[model samples]
Target chain A: MSVDLRSAFFYSRKDIFKNIKIFIIITLSIILATANIIVINGLIDGMIEDLVDNTVESSVGHLNIYPDNNERFIEGIGIKEQRLATLKEVEAYSPRISATGVLSNKELSVSSTILALDPDKERKTTKLLEKLVRGAAVNPNDKNAILVSSRLAEDLKLDVGDEATLAFENGIIKVYNVKGIIRTGNLDFDSSTVIMPMDEAYRQLAIDNMASIILVKLSDKSMSEIYKPMIMQNLDVNNIRTWEEETEFVSNFANSWRSISSIISGVGLIAAAISVGIVIYINIIHKKRQIGIMKAIGTSNAFIFTVFLMEAAIFGVIGVFIGDSVGYLAIKYFEANPFLDAISQTWISARFEPQLFYIATIFSFGVTILAGVYPAIKASRVEIIKAIWGT
Target chain B: MEIIKTSNLKKSYMLGNVEVKALNGVDTSIEQGEFVAIMGPSGCGKSTFLNLTGMLDTPTSGEIYLEGKDVTNMNSNMRAEYRLKYMGFVFQFFNLFNELTVMENVMFPMMLNKRSNYKERAKELLNLVGLGDRLNHLPSELSGGQQQRVTIARSLANDPKILLADEPTGNLDTASSIEIIELFRKLNQEQGQTIVMVTHSPEIGGMTDRIIHFRDGTIEH
Candidate 1:
């Protein structure tokens, strides 16, 4: 039958508003589901951003190289002999000497991961310079100057220019001047680290002409596969790791968060579907007689279905707009509020992203429309005689 | 020429293993431009007969011919098309879409037919029904008589050949019932519109050109 599009629109709109409570409930359910989806997705994105920022800023460059024997943790009187490559092959590279040590002052002592790096090369290889909370980057030529984390400095009561004694294995001990303090907002790294020049580390540990590992930065991430094997072959090092491989813990954590968020969003979607279905079903029941009257007046079933679907589409649009606004405002509030500091300290920082908001809104609207199908069909299937006679 | 003709029409209901016959081998014909009323007591199958003729219900057995075309076994879609092109209906309750204004209610059928100038046509119909001044009023805002008048205007939206009214005045007061009957009479006399109304009120039934009394699923006269 030729259905009147305008009449269907008018009739559906009237029915929707006439039963205001159902309309409101359907819209509210859609909004809540959409908000949950947006917030969960936002949280996961924030966590990934934080993990990548922390990993890239601290020590792991885009790539890393270690001696073939470095994996066995061999204890020797001196550093292991290994062939090193020319610096010209890499965009940038930094030598690092990593070992466990104890930091001590007049009043306090703490165990920390002591990383000795060539500061000038480190600056070019990573975002280390941007993460400093106080003082300057370590001087490549200063033998006694060292940089410690803010938490370590706080624990040891050491300030810039203060002398701190570091004790290593085999009765090795060195006293160093605190040059700077750094806070990366990552508790795992910020609470237990110390940085010094590689030469200073070699002298203190009684090693000569040796470095534990080399960190390299490529011009682009896509070039990692090409450079990784070349770097290993040139340096004669079989033990190597990329940033993604070395940071399995953080990557796994982010993956788990993603999966959990998807599950939550899935549940929210199902709830939205059920809510819309129930609302449309009840609406059809309430309007059966009206539908019958329309049909008896020569309206087609297709027209009836279109009318209900249009009502659902309208609800979806309104709900998506409302949910997106609320979700964005909530994210913005979290970004501006100091109460989120606890999360930032442990996880990642939050930021506003308009793209995510739009994506969530469109997704919510699509879901609402899909959920409207069965109810519309049921409404259109109403028999005219039974409906009009209340049978 | 006959606008509606039915032969050996039968309809039955299964009420928990009890077969109740609503229409039993009923043969009837309605001529074009003729005003007729079907009168019967409660449960005498007056409504069932009207529904069958209106194409709203299917007869269990037999054939229905509209303008010499067999439509007994046609699909629901075809039935709807036939109804839209050839028939109009008014219910006992004045079944106006309560949310719509008087003009909108009148324009509904015209919209279904994809008729152009729907606004102008709706306004003209409302004026003809003496509701031009109340065109913007909702169905709930109007009196029962006024609501029925709107229903009458709605029935004429497509200018259908026949108007099948099922108890059109069943719920109205005496004065309102008389008004509706007079309107139907005018449509038949002036517009040459055929009308078949099912009513229990003998007073209203007396106004039609012919009366077919029904008893136990069969027409008596």
Candidate 2:
């Protein structure tokens, strides 16, 4: 009378424990696979977060606002104060004039995208001044002041307090003294972008009181989605863009990475499962005679099968514990001192998220149990006479 | 008072598509509390007869009666249940699970049958077989004769009606063989346990109350 369900487990515990080598091998395989998934997932996730953060801090703020007609890049969005009346969550907002033009110095000339912005309001919206590597931030009062990337400064052969000429595609030209050299490290932006005062830009491009776009800032980046509707009802629905929607390439890269890593983890799990299956199959074959004798002595076939499954589950639990412990430590280490990618100048941190832990545990157990089924069936179907004779 | 009676019992095997008869239409009977030994040369089907009588295998054709009830047609699982309840078996190899201690091996059948107080029963059986002090010893730790004693104890774990032994001393030396035969003789005489054993040695057969001779899968006239 086995009243206690765990009696069988304790009964056979020594049988599996005696085979320490097999347990060690299975545990190591699971630990290695689980740790790999955790670390790799964290690294990829971290890289995408860094890219989004850099973009938000340097250019897109949180949301972009435009005029009622979406197709026409509707210059100024909130030139009339009533258009932005409902924006309570907005931390900062700036009106900007944007154009693509050529910048020329005494020796070199290169085509670049130009932004005309208020130094005070734009400072609060985009933090354009904090990215400065040299000189000072552009001033709205100094109509002749311009900001350039260090990379762009080198490309145009211009320096701070140096004279430079800015030309629009519509054949308009203006001269200004270089105010700052900023380095955001975003390759496309760093290589070809320049900035000036909104009034000076509009006057030089033959524009009037209207600006090209309004960049809005929210306290939290995630709040942009929630507040987008409230802000959209006051303006044009079709012309509103959250920073996440505007940064399509980052999301695309993140999505593609997720797909590729999932495939890699899938293959790793299969390999681990196959390894476990092979080991357990060999164990069943080795224990064939014992299984036969158990059946011969009145132990049911189902009992033998259940013991095998229990053995696999034991291995699964131990493996998950060790793997998750190691993985959690690795994540913490990487979170504190991230893996640096010198090429992108970004720190890739490993996040110790609860979801990753849950997934790793479930995956390890699922594959281990699935591996046990065939061997368990084989043990239950053994012929008692043959096994006794062999013994 | 027939404990087991077999009528026209036959069993056949396939040896690469050729039929080989292991038991051929044999009719056999043994009374309750009888100590019986079936004697034959190797491959004479004496072991096969004991296996069929123990319900370890089903007959190819014919019937087996246990207490006047037909059991030859019982399914394997039901037959296993019957084996657990009313039959015990001792193999020539003394097939104790290598990992289990002597007492644990004795407790296996009782555990399966849900017999309460099995731990105490297993201890008593081990003490009866004179290995009481060796309860915690693994089978590999004991000698061949001691291990055989363990098997005998395990066979009687559920206090079954009949003990079926196939070449029980075939692997023992002369001294151990005589010792095991005397043990079986004592168990039958004192406990009145019905035992059907198959053996090649006539010297061992002489100790039993009855000897049934078998030749080429049939009882000798």
Candidate 3:
């Protein structure tokens, strides 16, 4: 009995090893599909993280506070002036005055969105200073010092120390030194945004203690949801949009990427399942007679199935490992490339994160094992008599 | 005393709307330590009879007793166990797994039975068959006669009470056939093994202690 079991194991092992070409092909297919899943998942994860980071740092807080007539800001001129006792309640708040205008230098002119901010207060609440790519932050004392996005600066052919005239509504023109160029990932922001001190912006727009919105940052992200209702009840606010609600465009874009990644991963998993099924089915067909001979010689169906399942599992493991490694390397390579920086400035923004690697590895391995089940079952159900007689 | 007995054994194959009766109401008996040759023309169900006796196939309607245990109604797994424990078969095609060495082939059945010291027993069998020096050779590397000797060693691996051969030398040349016959004769005479061999050759059949002629699925004499 021992001899029979030893021979069976030896034969099964030899059979598996002898079919190295099939093994390699199956492994490669699984690896390719797994790699695609991992890389796509990684990219989606990175994109979402980048979107959230940019949203939180550049514009939206975990929460937002505004006047009761804030809903009117979407269509027409909003609250011209308001006294917000925000310092006593929130962690930090930056008063913002924003409008669409045209920026011009000697050689070029472009339409841009202008933001007026209190530099000291904004610095305490936002990431504007850290995102500067070419110049210094806007001086709170210099009424004419303005910061422009990298794309806008490039379009107007303006650099640090250059003079640029900002033309606002009612023929108001403010000339300012190009204090800094910043790059945020949002294409809309990167191409057409300019920042100036709040007082200077109020003067340009002919406003008094007026602002477009008041941005708030809290100590805890979850606190936004809790504090939003209290702020609404205490203050005569028209609407309260959280950072999550404010960054709808970025959120939507990230959501779409997530959907696409899921679809791709789903398709990859299906293809893997089919590939494994077909390969194992073919293997069963090829070895039908051998299977019969083994059964006839007293080998059990369970044992035969186990051998095939082991082969499928081996394929899955090998493929998942190789694919995950390749996908990780690809993501890393893209993250570190200078071209990515250029692309981020021009199109979408990105950051290199290690967390994506772990997520990808887990997803790749999981999908591979899921894909192996059908093939393993089919292989196990091979009928001994029919297999022996080629039926 | 009879070691194997089958009563009213019947088998049929359905070949796409046509029922081909492979065996019909066959009754036979063989004693222990007896060398018997079953002889028949083509389509006489000689091979089918061997399959039933070896527990490789089930009868359509019959009762079979091996060592006085009724086994016709045994399930597949049980039949396999019985075959593994009490029977050994040599096929016409030499049905050796091509990848295994001669020693490994001989050791296969013994391993299945969980027999200890398989190498020692395998070597003894190989030496008994005069192929001890060729243990490491693969089936393809040996001549027809040598390959049949390996099959013989394999069949004897489980220490079965009865050995069944279905044209064991059918594919071999004249010298190989005679050599296999001589081996079978010696195994029966020296080791006192009960062997039932099916052969078409009258000359070889004549050498057995008893020759049962089969015709139309029934043993005549």
Candidate 4:
């Protein structure tokens, strides 16, 4: 028959049902590859998002301002209130003085970070007040009271209301009662944090209101690029850093992870493409006689080629579509019930990326089209007489 | 008037550097509405000459005139176009698309053309070929004779100017062969359909208007 493209398309689709084995194999291959890509990419993105959130909430705020040149600590809000509030990006700011000190009882001593900050302002910037595992939040009224992480307290074997002496730099020493125990999701930070009233820390360090750092919290961290320059332009400070800058480890991990995902997904799909290619090759070769008959009957080469190519494309689309639907269900399931980090006490959910679907669809269709080229051409160029004679 | 005429028709093969002439410098003609049979031994170039005449293969050297038009030099695509528009073919093996039903197979030739009467015409042809009831049956589901009937039905789908059959009953038993040859004789006598066939059977050849016997690629009578 003189087959038109429309007839060939419908014929090829119906023929796919006739050859169910090859159809099933090609469909399953695309499904497996597509599902693997979506799930793996979701997991990776989920981990990165969790890391960024935890870092921002635990240690760094949206931005950080250290002292100017030739100095380590900045003495209070060197940038005036009118100047700070005028930027419009500053949602809230926490001023704190940090020092490395040793806390000891009669039996043990461990080095840790001591932060002296206003309890009210710190609560607005971080989750310290909300994440208290035992005892109350830090008290600004008690000059001799301090807060410690549950990990740090465990390390020193200290509890709330227990008296421990803290030794600071420049030979200053003081004894204080532990008032609260807090647990942050980060293991490293949890094991080394000690908090006290800002006035008491200045007295112990004898630094005269020279706060070590001021963390500037923004309404949106993503707008740091626009706000950072404005903040820098407003203040005479040179050492300000954003949360993304402070958490370089997370960014590096995310970048490395993306490359790995690409390699793994790329390899799987290419293998599938080659497999589908081989099947198409076999199909065309086996049907050489039929193709020859068609050619002799005046069926155009282009029409025959379009038939096979359309068949391959339909395989890719149908398979990827089914796989994507199943994968989306998986993504939503994971999103609703996140994996638990028992040690950090955190819940992390995967990020569902729609681009994964777009990329997978395009790649799958591309693979089949590319693979079908040689076989389609071979089918189109069948030697009519030899093939019809079965030679 | 001659519907097909060949002048100095030649076809050869280089089998391992040895030249084997399948058809060597033979000239022949068949008038329109004539039923002709070609008889030859194996390897006497009967099938080669049929292929050259049908444009199924290019001749090694010769000029072939179809309705007084020189078609020997036409390209493969043009030859295919000409053949599709004006000729029908029946093969020994039935060569029906095994996957298609009898009806679909019958409609295949006309399907190449955008004809609206394909279904009704195919049904009419199948009924005429005594396979009207087996329209939905695949070739594998039918007897060899029934399958040959389907190919014959398919051969008339395009309503072409000429019908070419190459050992149309080579795979059939005596009874089926007689029936098929009788159908060809009926077609030639009733409809004035020009028919050219190749066969080894003298009984079948005797039913035709003329039988051209070939020996060493030339007509003996």
Per-residue lDDT of model 4, residues A290-389, tens digit only: 7777776667777778878877787888888987887788888899999987876877787788897787677766876787788778787888888889
What are the per-residue Cα lDDT tens digits for candidate 4 across B4-73? 9999999998899999999998899999999999999988888888888888888889899999999999
Across A1-391, the per-residue lDDT of candidate 1 in tens digits comes to: 5666787778778777876787788888888888877777776677676667667666587777665562522223132223322434467777678888998998689988888877787888877766777788887788878889988999898888899998875468888888899877668667888888878777778775556777777777557767778776665567778887777777888888889988888888788878887887787888789889988987778988898888788888888888888788777765565233454354444556777777777778888888888889988899999999989
Task: Specify the poorest-scoring 10-residue window by lDDT in model 4 chain A.
Answer: A75-84
Score each candidate by Cα lDDT.
Answer: 0.82, 0.82, 0.75, 0.83
Report the lDDT tens digits of candidate 1 across residue range B1-221: 99889899899999999999998888999899999999988898899988988899999998888888898888888888778878889999888988788998888788778889989999988888889999999999999999999999998998889899999998999999999999999999999999999999999999999998999998886
Could you arrange the candidates by TM-score from highest to lowest?
4, 2, 1, 3
Give the best candidate by TM-score: 4
Return the clash pairs for model 4, or none.
A1-B112, A2-B112
Per-residue lDDT of model 2, residues A106-195, tens digit only = 768989989888888888888666888889987777788889977789988788889898888789887879998877767887888898
Shift in Å, residue A292, candidate 2: 1.2
Clashing pairs in 1: none
lDDT of 1 at A223: 71
lDDT-wise, the better of 3 and 4 is 4
Can you tell me which runs of candidate 1 are displaced by over 4 Å? A2-7, A17-25, A28-32, A70-91, A104-110, A129-138, A141-145, A150-164, A175-181, A233-236, A321-362
In DockQ terms, which candidate is top? 1
Q: What tens-digit string does per-residue lDDT give for candidate 3 at A1-391?
A: 1223445456656555656787787777777777776667666666666667666877776666554562413222233112234434476767687788899998588988888888887887888667888878987777878889988988988889999998896588878889889887667788999988877876777676555677777777667778888766655565778887786777788788879888887787677767776877776667677666666666555556656666666667777878778877777765565234354542222343566555545665565555555654665566644554466
CA RMSD of each candidate after superposition = 3.8, 3.1, 4.8, 2.8
The TM-score of candidate 4's chain A against the true chain A comes to 0.88
Q: Per-residue CA lDDT of candidate 3, range B1-221, in tens?
A: 89989999999999999998888888889999999999999989898898888887788898889988898888766876777777777877677777678998888777777888999999999999999999998888998889889888888888888899989879999888998989999999898789999999998898899998889888775
